[model samples]
Target: MADRRLAIEAWESLFRAQHEVFEVLSNDFVGTDLSQAEYDVLLTVTRSPAMTARLRDVTANMLISQPSVSRLVDRMVGRGLVTKCNDPDDGRGALVTATDLGVRAFRAIGAAHGKRIAEQMSRLDDDELLALRALTEKLRAGVDVDEA
Candidate 1:
């Protein structure tokens, strides 16, 4: 096996770096209509077909718990950012669709957030970024992500 100390050190450094970079990127939500969680919701929803995504899928993409996601989606629904309805294919599942307002908000925040992310990641050159992506994908390869 790899050296235990080196493994721990590598894990710690990766965790801390992710935390710090996320903290910096989260500032893009300040003074905006969407909270980071809401933005995350829109991030998943807007990328799906017809600007709609399954509720389970949203929960999957989110860092928060399933109940919390349900509540957040409710709030978004109340705010007219998204509409929720039963998933036709699955009786127990819900489908979320972004409203025109939601799309606008997501696009506005995404443009700024994308720029900020690029600026923060500029510390790494193209080759390093590609390597980082490959490393992360490899790390995630063992994780079992559920689509249902």
Candidate 2:
């Protein structure tokens, strides 16, 4: 086992780095039609097949509570960004589909947000970035994540 002290220090470093980068990258959302949280939801939705995703899948990717996610989806529905309907596969679950406007906005924000992320991550070379991703993935590998 690694030294407990070193383990704690490494965890702290990873946490702080993620928080700091999140703070810095959040500036990319300013003056945008979508907030950071909304962008996250759309990110998951847009990446899914047919620009649609299960609400639970979105909820899984979000840090917020399920109820909060539902509320956000409702707001997005009001904005004509997405539509919600009962999942055919799961009667108790719902599916969220991105509207054309939602896809447009997501793509618009995504282009710049992606560039900003790349710029922030540029501090590390490609190899370092790959290693970082590997380490993170390894860390998360203990948990089971569903691919949808």
Candidate 3:
């Protein structure tokens, strides 16, 4: 029990540190109209070979609720950043894809984010990076597949 508590606290600390780093990167580096959530959505869609995804897929990938994703997608559509199209295969599902403007915005912001992360982590040696990845993966193993 004590070991679990200690692990939880350590995980929280790591999460906080990562959040702080993201905040700094977000504020000073990626200063575009796109929010972090939007950027993530765009990246997930763009990374896929089809460069498109269904609403449910976006919600799952973004780790957000359906309503939340709907609202966000609504906003993105309003901004002409993305489009909601009827899925040809499934008449009921909507396919979401980034617009040309959305792709442009994503590229600009993503480059900045990548550069920021690279600059921040540049001081870490290869061994330290590997250690961090191993530790984080170990902590991630705590989440049961059944729970997921």
Candidate 4:
């Protein structure tokens, strides 16, 4: 019982910390060309091979619902930040590729955002940051099994 209670408390702390950090980081996007959601999508898209990713891959990386991601992608397409095309390898799947405009925008925002993230995280010492990263990855791996 004590163990379970401790686990619950730890989880709550983790959740609150994530929320707080998210709120702080979200401020960085206020006047930018991308919303947090759009930046998230672009981040994943940009990280993928050749700066293109499958729609399902993007949805998987995002915290938003599949429908929400679809809608967001449509909005981004309309803005000319990304282009969607039928995946040649998978007839049922769509591929999202960052346009030159999207790449430029992402690069501009990413530089500042990266610095902001580093600054925010600087509160943690290097050792603590390494431990936190390992712990979070472990937690994610546990959850990912269920997700898969």
Best by lDDT: 1
Window of ten residues with lowest summed lDDT in model 4: 139-148
Q: Report the lDDT tens digits of candidate 4 across residue range 18-86.
A: 899899999989898989999999999999999999999999999988899999999999999999999
The residue-by-residue lDDT of candidate 2 on 1-148, one tens digit each, is 8899999999999999999999999999999999999999999999999999999999989999899999999999999999999999999999999999999999999999999999999999999999999999998885665542
Q: Which run of 10 residues does model 2 get worst, by summed lDDT?
A: 139-148
Writing each residue's lDDT as its tens digit, candidate 1 over 28-133 gives: 9999999999999999999999999999999989998899999999999999999999999999999999999999999999988999999999999999999999
lDDT of 4: 0.93
Lowest summed lDDT across 10 adjacent residues in model 1 is found at 139-148
| Global fold similarity of model 2 (TM-score) | 0.93
RMSD of each: 2.3, 3.0, 2.8, 1.9
Best model per TM-score: 1
* Candidate 1: count of backbone clashes, pairs at least 3 residues apart or interchain: 0
Compute the lDDT of residue 73 as modeled in candidate 2. Answer: 97
lDDT values, one for every candidate: 0.96, 0.95, 0.84, 0.93
Pairs in clash, predicted candidate 3: none
